[model samples]
Target: MGDRRLAIEAWESLFRAQHEVFGKLSGDFVGSDLSQAEYDVLLTVTRAPDMTARLRDVTANMLISQPSVSRLVDRMVGRGLVTKCSDPDDGRGALVTATEEGAHAFRVIGAAHGRSIAEHMACFDDEELRTLLTLTEKLRGYRSGE
Candidate 1:
């Protein structure tokens, strides 16, 4: 019973921390060309080879639903931020590639966002940050069977 209580406490703390941090970070996107969701998509796509990634891969990395991602991608395509093409290796799949314009916008916002994140995270010391990273990775890895 004590262990279960402790686990619940830990989970609540983690959830609250994430919510607070995300709420603060969301402000960083104001006046940018992208929403936080769009920036997240670009982050994944820009890091992939040739600045392109499979739609499924992007969906897997995102926190949103597949249909939501599809809609967002369509909107981005219309905005000329990304291009969608039939995946060469999978006829049924689509590939998303960040356009040069998209990459430039990402770079612009990403730099400022990075600084904003660092500022918000400044409360954590290096050792605490390392431990937090390790614990979060362990939790995620366990769920992912990694």
Candidate 2:
């Protein structure tokens, strides 16, 4: 078993670092055409095949609730950021596709956001980054031995 005090200290350090980095990175959205959450949505949608993805899939990547995501998508549809249509594969599901304008916006914001992320993470070298990635993935059950 792990040492409880050491585990708690590690968790606190990780949480605080994430919070600070995220706070700094959130500035990338200020005065931009897209908000941070919208960028997150596009981050998932833009990577999908043909820039289209199931609404459920997008929601899976988001930290919000399904209803909240649905509402956000509706808002994006109104802004010409994306289009929503019924999913052929799932009767109850919807599909979201990034518009030309939306894709362009995502690329613009994504570039700067990428830079900001790199700047914030610059304190860690490549090997340390790899370790951080491995540990975080493990925490999320992603790197668990299959």
Candidate 3:
């Protein structure tokens, strides 16, 4: 019973911390060409080889639902930030590639966003940061069956 209560407390703390941090960090996107979700999609797309990724792969990396991701990708396409093409290997699957403009915007926003993250995380020492990363990844991996 004590262990279960401790677990619940820990989970609540984690949830509240994430919500606070994300809410604060989301301000970095204001006035940028991309919203937080759009930037997230571009992050995966831009990091892939040839600046392209499978749409499903992008969806997998995102926090949003697959349908929401598809809609977001459509809006991004309309904005000329990305281009969509049918995957050659899998005809039913679509691929998303960052346009030159998209890459440029990502780079510009990425530099500032990196600074924002660093500022927010500066409270943690290197060891603490490492431990945090390891624990979070462990939690995620458990859910992902890794």
Q: Which candidate's TM-score is highest?
A: 2
Model 3 stretches astray by more than 4 angstroms = 142-146
- Runs in model 2 deviating more than 4 A are 144-146
RMSD of each: 1.9, 1.0, 2.1
- Write down the worst ten-residue block by lDDT for model 2: 137-146
lDDT of 1 by residue, 55-128 (tens): 99999999999999999999999999999999989999999999999999999999999999999889999999
Better of 1 and 2 by TM-score: 2
Per-candidate TM-score against the hidden true structure? 0.94, 0.97, 0.94
Candidate 2 per-residue lDDT, tens place, 29-93, comes to 99999999899889999999999999999999998999999999999999999999999999999
lDDT of 1 at 66: 98
TM-score quality measure for candidate 1: 0.94
On TM-score, who's better, 2 or 3?
2
List clashing residue pairs in candidate 1.
Answer: none
